[model samples]
Target chain A: MQELGSFLEVLISGLLAGVLYSLVALGFVLIFKASGVFNFAQGAMVLLAGLALVRALDFLTRLGFPGWLAIMLGFVFAALVMALCAFLVQRYVLGPLINQNALTMFMATIGATFVIEGVAQFVFGSEVYPLRLFPTDAWIAAEATFPGGILINKLDVWGGVIAGLLVIALALFFQYTKTGRALRAVADDHAAAQSVGIPIDWIWFVVWLVAGLVALVAAAIWGTKLGVQFSITFLALKALPVLIIGGFTSVPGAIIGGLIVGAGEKVAEVYLGPFIGGGIEYWFAYVLALAVLMVRPQGLYGEKIIERI
Target chain B: MGQFKTSYAKDMVIFPIRQDRIGVYLLLGFALVLLPLMMAFHVPPFRTDYFLLAILLPFLILSLAAIGVNILVGYCGQISLGSGAFMAIGAYMAYKFGTGISEIGLPPLPIVFAILLGGLSAAFFGVLFGLPSLRIKGLYLAVATLAAQFFFDWVFLRVKWFTNYAPSGSVSAPELKFFGYLVATPVEKYMVALIFVIVFALIAKNLVRGNIGRQWMAIRDMDIAAELMGIRPLVAKLSAFAVSSFIIGVAGALWAFLRLGTWEPLAFDINRSLELLFMVIIGGLGSILGSFLGAAFILIVPIFLTVLPAELGIPITTGTVSHLQNVIFGGMICCILIKEPLGFARLWQIGKEKLRMWPFPY
Candidate 1:
């Protein structure tokens, strides 16, 4: 019964953690879907957002600003800065290398990662920063006692609801709006979309802007969970395994994959850990993704194509 | 003389022309025996102090790791950020085997063999991780491989059994010797490492020149084209993973046994993997000699940066040195990649081609 209780608790936490992971992976998927450039700087972007939040909070405390206003200002600053980064990348790096293959673009992104890391470390000293979200008492306590009942955190629940709603809103936007239609058209095939008079460049710009905004939100929630730190970049790396298990280009796949990895890692750590001397949780997600990849190269939701093209 | 040189028998020789054969034999003979003798006998006082273990071991191990990476990224066109994880696997496995055998008094040969076996185990894991390459490409594949890196690091760091439930969570290598000659000294360790690196490098060079190498190149150039050309993607890709991992595994062993002699899991972290990848990229991906140049540049340049600043009485703090190191390292990689995306090997090739036409303007 104790083991069963622990397993349930692990499963619950895993799913909740998965929701946050989905948000991060969504940022990756959106960018990849619009522009085939794999943004190696995604992790750095998360760090940037978390750092921005901390800086904003510190300033608010000094200036005697309200908690809510400070938080709002931090989000605004993060979103604006990320959007600006997207614009710069699109204009300078991606524009010149528009005709280059995926490999070249990937290299360019790696360069971007170095620049971000170097600049960030130089500006903000290489130390962990703590970020506090408003409403600390928002956690949900399990009142019913059935052999050491699990109490789920309200912050996680709020994060899940917000993430789900955002995903739905995005789905709706893609389904209905003209810009969304154009974005979809571009994603399908740039040349084909261009021939039909869809402004490919504008669509690409907007996609990146939205993706950056998503990253900002992800950064905030994760910062609240684990405290903002430079190592948060590695946490963002958690999304890559999520991407592998989920299809690279599929939004739903990202969400589902994140949940599976989050839940899987947590449960493995709690259970099978003792057998292998524990901490299999760290790598279990990737190994699971690898196993899945071996079985189905296209991933869970990825389309299967015959390779003779 | 032209007719004699043109004979198939003379042309087909391993050293081909007479002068080439003589030069080859002379170089090998020196490297095998003469280099050791020279280092032992003719070392200046300043140079003797310069031969610090920290400086030499990182160079040797980093070069080996870079070669391992070059096989995958350079030859096979597989991008992996998990080479460090494989190294960790090797180190921990070696540590585990090294201690386990010695604790039970199972002789030194078996213990030494255990280190090689540790490397083989890492190779096994490498192939396991490399399987995803069959589907993913470019960045997705990079992310996928990264999972392997994180997993292995976590396993080795957090798992107690792997560390033999040691209280401090670090492992050490016992005194190693070969044929009753103690290899406890820095110079002796350097010689052992040099021997293994040379042997593996030769095997890597020969492998790259063979049918397997051709298949890897074909897959790299165009997987579809290669598949149409009757090359099996699975076979070619997996073999690349296997061989690459094998090389990396050995490097990991050297790192633990010789360099650290005692280390924890953090010794083979993600940063090291990135460093190895950078070595391959800066070294020229497809060239065997490029691996050495890249490794030397990456490993040696930092030491030069750190030392040259201090040697001239320029008193730079350690923190400042580290920060400057990052900035310079980042800037150099960008510059090198931008100037010669083909890497240092291409530069070597250009120089060689120029040497062939030394006196003529044409």
Candidate 2:
């Protein structure tokens, strides 16, 4: 009973953690889908967004604004920052090198990553800033069913709820909005979309802006959970595996993939950790992703890639 | 003088121009004979051993690894984030061979042999991880290589057996005795690396100019077309992986043996892999000269940056220095990619061409 109870606790936490990973992976998917770019700077964007928001939130609250008002104002400031970043990146950095090969663009993003990281840290000091947006305490929901009630983190539940809502909103935007339709068309076939009178550059800017906003959402949850720091960039490492598991183009795939990775790594760390030196979560997620790649290179939900000479 | 190449043999010569050959000879002479003599005579810049130990040694070793990366990425068009893993394999494997396990009654191998063996092991792992390339392409392949990176990182860090049960996790290089001549001095150590780099670089240059090199380039250009045109993708890709890893492994072995006397697994992480990739891109992808150029630029520029600030009497914190380096390098990479995708090597070629045609133009 004790073993099962502990396993249940690990499983729930893993699923919740998976949502956070999905949030980061979601940003990668949006850019990759629209621009055909493997944006290495996505991690840096998250850090930037988190920094912009947290610093703003801190300032606004210190000025004696109400808690809710300060949070909303922080979101607005971060969104503006992200919008500026998108315009510059999509307009300047990615604008000129439009038709270059994937490899070149990828390298450029890595370069962009350094620039973003430098600017973000330079503007907002490199010290860790605590964000108490979400409650960090836990709730035990099932005392009668198990020996010890399953320890559920209140923060994880809030993060999960926020992520779910964002996904629903993004799906609606994609399915219903004209701009979203244009974004999909561009993603499906860039030349065709452009031929059909879509503004290729403008659409790319929009996609990036949306990705940046998604990153803001991720920053909020992740910031509150871990206290925003440079270490947040490491989230890119975690998100890459999720990107592999969930197809790079699928929103639901990101969520499910995150869940699988979260649960899988948590279970492995708890059970298989002692035998093989612990901290297996990082590589364990990657190895799992590698296995999935072997079986299905396009991932669980990615469209099948057809090649022609 | 430009019309002297009358035959195929003349055209195929490594340095087709007489002036180029003379220039290369002069450069080699300086590196081999003049540089050391200058240090011995206590020249201003060469007065301190810091130039030899800190800058030149790392530059040479990194150039060797960059050459390896250039072979795979620049020439063959296969992106790998696992060079760090291959380097780790080379380092750990060399250490394992250099200091044999007592339980197996195996005497420690010669340092040269151990280094070669380490390179061979890295090449083997390279081929293994490279299997995914057959199925995936582009970004997928790049991300997939991270599996190797993370896995090897864990193995070296956690596996107690690899460290020879040393109380401290860090492993120290054994004595670098080449047939009983101990490389005890910093100059001797530099000499070993310089020789290793020159030999391997020449070999890499020759290999890339050969038939196999053409095949790798063909696959890189378009695998399907190359396959239809009779260059086997499997063989070409795998051979690229093997050769690239072999060179990188040697660099890793040399790095462990020469540069870092005492080191830990953390030394060869993802950042190291990224740095090697940076050398390949910022230097020149397919050009041998580009690898050396890129390695020097990545390494030497930071020193200049650090020195310039202090020389100006600006008291800068170390963290700011590092962050500044990142911003400058990152900005340079972007600017280079946007304006001149071919990199510094291309710039070098353009300058030489212009110089050849100076004082006149069409």
User: Which candidate tops lDDT?
Assistant: 2
The per-model lDDT (C-alpha) reads 0.78, 0.91
Residue-level lDDT tens digits of model 2 in A201-258: 9999999999999999999889999999999998988999999999988889999999
Q: Write the per-residue lDDT of candidate 1 for residues B95-140, one digit (tens) a residue.
A: 6676665566754344467678778988899888887788776666
Clashing pairs in 2: none
Q: Which stretches of candidate 2 lie over 4 Å from their true place?
A: none
Off by over 4 Å in 1: A1-9, A64-69, A91-93, A141-150, A172-179, A193-205, A274-276, A305-309, B1-52, B95-107, B110-115, B132-144, B158-165, B304-339, B351-362
Backbone clashes under 3 angstroms, per model: 2, 0
Q: Give TM per candidate.
A: 0.87, 0.98
| A131 Cα displacement, candidate 1 (Å) | 1.4
| Model 2: how far residue A246 lies from native, Å | 0.9
What's the DockQ of model 1? 0.35
Chain A (candidate 2) TM-score to true chain A:
0.98
Pick out the ten consecutive residues of candidate 1 chain A with the lowest summed lDDT: A134-143
- CAPRI accuracy category, model 1: acceptable
In model 2, the Cα lDDT at residue A238 comes to 90
| Among all candidates shown, the one with the greatest TM-score | 2
